[model samples]
Target: MGRMGRIIISVIVILGLLALGLKGCSTTLRKAVFAKAMPGSYFAEYSRIHPSLYQVSGQVYAFEKEFARSMILRTPDGIAVFDTFDTAHMISLKQTLEQEWPQESVRWIVLSHNHLDHIRGSDVYPKAEVIGHKDINQLVADWPNVNSDIASVTREISDDQTLTFGDVTVEALYMPFSHSSTIYGFHIPSDNVVFAPDMMFVDAVPPFGFPDFYYPGYIRALDRLIAVNAEHYIPSHMDRGTRADLIAFRDMTVEFQGVVEDEYLKIDPEDFIQGIGMGDAIKSAYDRLHPKYGHLHGFDAMFVPKFGRHFGGTYLGY
Candidate 1:
């Protein structure tokens, strides 16, 4: 081979190797996406907020921003908690509840899902009826880390099950898995308030990774929520929002789905690693909503991998 030709060949080989190395570095397993700890910020701010409750009529109270868990107490009956906090947070929440209404007892500890942070405080309400989606029951029964204390009172709730305690009515709706396999979105029909955890997540767009895996279902779940026509919405993570917030979330998910569908139609999955590919609609929606509603700390890390997964799984079901 000629000297010039040999050098050109070597250059191409070097470039190929460099590209492969860069690709390897960006994959999901590389720990490329992670959120930083706020260090007492969430708790401190939450504590100062002084949990506010909105009575949606008929013994139903929407407890706003309280100790990790927001509750709905049915006066003259018992209390039903939406989502409980971590172990320590649960204890604190219980104490706060007692301080506010010492006479009332938490009769039912209903979970949005079996995610650790949400159900960590299950031990607090000893006699309370622990309720969740059937999947949640499976998760606990098959959990790698089972807390015996919390498992005793657990009960699996079917889709569209209604729990009525005196004047209060809490409805559980089954939502497809996004963060965890077993998840449910709760709705209060009387108050037109929906208690959706990660599905209608209030904080951070949720740890979205696989579009084909579970995100499409996430979008569908929102569609169902919109069908509810709930006037008021309570999210698990961030602050309570007006109907506009729910609309925005629904719109964003649609835009996100559109981007995934477009890419799936236009490109080969293998080319996904070439670069970031967001369509005009997706980019516009994300750019507008992210600053105010997005989880800034998590976006930089989680979005790319999530995109990558969505790319690969475009045709393949997750």
Candidate 2:
């Protein structure tokens, strides 16, 4: 390896050892790799944000609290919420909801998936009926806090279903095994808006390859999302989205998978010494991909780690 590459590896190893476990090592390495890879800022413009409560269409609105975002719609019945984003953001989120549509009551909340971060904070709307996929029926029943009184899933959806409340009709698209089996996308026909988790990042790579990610499942779910043709898409993590944004993310995923597979196939078993070969392979993939996707947010810091994750998963029988 060249001096620059060796220096990069050394910095990552030192940071990894000092600050984090294998996961921390990945996080630490992203910044270092991005710094060395370019002269300009490695972080993408889209990665930066000014969190706020904003409206997308007439009644469809979104509130951003730190990294958590919630999509709210003002309907005839009351106000409908997609996901809470986080329990920690309850105070701020509730305030935003009240301030934006004070007259409207929080009638119901539909969970995009069962991930704790997105599903928490339903207690803020005590009267609101909590809705989730049938997959999480047992999960909701078991959770002490939810089933008791403050919050509980009053209704459950098993497959693709439509809900007409107020003036809008919401279509729930069941997505299994993309990010998780519990994921469901809610589509509003009136506003041409869709809300869900694991759809796609706005203009950046995902922080990592999650343990539950199934390549075939992601592809299938993504294709289904495209067919829905909602002009606006709200991923719980980042609410600002367009059809182009999702398409770009899907393209990136397809390309990333292809490139990683080709690189993995070329890795010589003999080069496993000192972990040199694996590192080089990751670097090679980075070099090839950066020119195309480097402009996206977190590409430098997250690209190699993601590549490592997908490649590593291959080893574990992905």
Best-fitting candidate, scored by lDDT: 2
Model 2 worst lDDT window (10 residues): 37-46
Error of 1 at 15 (Å): 18
What shift in Å separates residue 144 of candidate 2 from its native position after superposition? 8.5
TM-score of each: 0.70, 0.79
Best by TM-score: 2
> Candidate 2, after superposition: displacement of residue 302 in Å?
1.9
User: What does the lDDT come to for candidate 1?
Assistant: 0.60
Question: Clash pairs of candidate 2?
Answer: 30-301
lDDT of 2 at 260: 83
Return the lDDT, model 2, position 178: 75
129-158 in candidate 1: lDDT tens per residue?
A: 887777665566676665443543367776
| Residue-level error in angstroms, candidate 1, position 274 | 10
